[model samples]
Target: MIINFSNLMFITLNIMSTLYMISANCWINCFLAMEINLFFFIPMIFSPNLFNMEMIMKYFIIQVTSSIMILLCILYYKNFIFNLILIILMNFCLLMKLGSVPFHYWYIEISNIISWKMFFMLSTWQKLGPMMILLYNFNEYIMIFSIIMNSTIGMLGGLNQISLKKIMSFSSINHLSWIIASSMISEIMMMIYIFTYTMMMFFIMMKFEQMNLINIFQLFFFKKKMMIMISFFIYFMSLGGLPPLMGFIPKWLTINKLMENKFILVSVILIMSSLINLYYYFKIVYYMNLNKNYKINFFIEYNFKFSFYLFNYLIMTNLSYLLIYMFYY
Candidate 1:
């Protein structure tokens, strides 16, 4: 109860700091808010001591370096160009915060060290605070850089991961490109994609937890059909954007927008990347279908009955919301 309460408090404080950054006219206050946000997360991540001390040390170094960069950038942000520099620093800070590429080693290590619950929070909720902070400082160039680098590296790097958590972390990164790209087209599309991605990820994470499944190939032993269904939910079609599914919508819109502007190479790259990226997701599918015998690999006892239902409801509701908004709005 105490830990949960403290977690709640930290989350609440971080959120308030983000809104303070958005509403604060004073630059000092804004940077302070960001600093508070950064510090709060470090404490939360380190509080358990479950992670490798080395990982904690590395995380601290990277975070402090990025924080200083943001501080210096804030000092120089007196005009548009300086603001651009600040934006770069701030986005880099988020890139650091979320463990996106060029600074992605932390993610690979952290997932191995931390608990899955912590991983889920770090992967999803921690990203939200940064997204809120970033929205106030949007520029097209920043979005483009974020999309291209995040998409290209995130997808390609994720291809080599065997840990389900690391794969999901990179999966989150891949969707980050789509989300950032969505901002370029329409707010509705962005919201829809994020909502769907979050919901689906919640299901995927919880399902993996319940099954005591850690790595990808472990799915091969689950005789339960429900597990297969869950695997399909994650792989075959997500919330309207992959291909021949509802999840394909945002990707289509994004590609079309880029093409209209004659971004032929970029479009081709994204398409090619997606084709390459689908391999791992399909691998899980193949493994789940290969073996008929169930051999439980997890020692930790888990009951996923409630989580499965909750996620089903969320996926359906969010998908419905996406359809309605796209059709009517």
Candidate 2:
């Protein structure tokens, strides 16, 4: 992996943007940080290959429009009715940037064309600043709407997709719904959800990149590696929020919080959507395990580090019951 000057600049800008969001005292500064982040990300997306011109244009237009909307909201923060409208607009813009439901088409399109590294950033890190800002100025009605729509859309959108990237894109949206729901109850829970989600996505992205896989059919080529197959099973199933997995911990906590707050309908909707997601996740695992001829490849290197990290996460998740008990007791 060779790092170039532009890549270095991109990393610098990303850091600055994140720092600004963390330290921002006002909405103006947060908006500026997001702008800087978007400006730098565009170059990073295009620098790898110029053929991504169309995708780049789409990304730029969407981000710039969102930024402009956010700016208008900031400028009109005084008038009650006007401010409410602007705030709703601002929420919609941020949702667009986050690639949540109804605004996720552009993100899915772009994900198919970009490198897995860029996609990883887009799926995880890129969401941080926008999510933080949205959480800070949280709106219950808008958040509830986003939560239901995003979860439902994410579940249904991925059911027929052959592209791995597209599947993950919808999965990202599904997870966003949970993250937003958790944020409504507790910021700490939301942060925990983000951390766990990022780690899971990172592991899956690295595996996909390592195999140079882009679609479901490509997974068959690596059928000889039982380790890889098992890992994939664990990772994807965990992502679907199966019990006794790291992904389930945050979800379980979120449900508890929701129930405590009498948000029964939201909790039920979340669980139903998760079950829909689990169907696809299981389908992937079944496809991977359909064949049983194991061949050893000496040339292929394994990701021992990530595997160990994942194992640790599994152990920690199993112990989470005790942690919860201690907290409650």
Candidate 3:
């Protein structure tokens, strides 16, 4: 309901820049598109709130620094004595941009102050352009190191967080490892994983926003609402990559692909870290399911909202179609 023309324009331009990066043949074009996308996105996160201004500043500083380094590396690529150093530097910059481990401090801090809508954008769309650029000339050794670090730190970071935003921030980092790994295997596989992740996060964020939830404890207030409970269970479980759910497909495929390519150690590490991710996800769902004796004046009617049915329908249909396609062919 609070739509702004300027915000819409920024969103469009940001998306266009992302597309440009994806199709760009050269590193210069990709870097330019990335900077444009970052600038466009910055305006959308600005607000009158003082705390949010700090968040904006931190995000801007980190992204600009990374951009500067990447640009420097690109400009000096021809003169550099070793191509390996350039690849490592560029890969590190992209990893920093993606908010993977070792560069994730800024990411978690910024997410804490942003709105849920911005959090969705930060976790999803903002990552696409940099990730696409990363595919151009990634270093295998650096990527493997990132895989190990991200899988470990991403899980450990979320273990004790009471804030929902922080938990999801860590979750995004954990998922980023899978995404980076998938990109190594196949671009198409990465796209499918990203698509599924975006959809699951979209629905979960919608539900959280609708209920005005900010932390794990807030879930106690909605325990009486069956529809909310059920929806939370489905979406969170899917996000955890549980089998028979839509989220598991991309993960299963990624593991299979990794094993196929003989990345057995990385595959095993990812699986172990995923189980830990699932642990925290299940902790959240458990919090929602816990019975509470508190009473409130307002009552949620037995009938559910339109969103509940719509989300469930989409999940079931997508899972069925995916199953048939993956197995049939």
Top candidate, metric TM-score: 3
**TM-score of every prediction relative to native:** 0.78, 0.90, 0.92
Off by over 4 Å in 3: 292-313, 316-318, 321-329
Q: Could you tell which candidate, 1 or 2, scores higher by lDDT?
A: 2
* Candidate ordering by lDDT (highest first): 3, 2, 1
Model 2 is weakest, by summed lDDT over 10 consecutive residues, at: 320-329
Give the root-mean-square deviation of each candidate in angstroms.
5.2, 3.3, 3.2
lDDT of 3 by residue, 41-66 (tens): 99888877888888788889989999
Model 3 scores a C-alpha lDDT of: 0.86
Please give, for residues 1-329, the per-residue lDDT of candidate 1 as tens digits: 13688788887887787667657876578668877876676656674454476787887787678767767766777755646667777777767766766777787787776666667666666566556556666677766776778778767776777787777667667777777776566666666666556666666666666687888777766655644555565534553245544456557777887788776766776676676567667766667768756444445345695465545655544355566446734
Clashing pairs in 2: none
Q: Residues 162-280, candidate 2: write the lDDT tens digits.
A: 89999888989999999999889876787778888888888888888888889887666664565576688778878898978768888988999999999899999999999999999
**Model 1 RMSD to the real structure?**
5.2
Between prediction 1 and prediction 2, which has the larger TM-score? 2
Candidate 2: which stretches are off by over 4 Å? 47-51, 79-81, 295-317, 320-329
| Predicted model with the maximum lDDT | 3
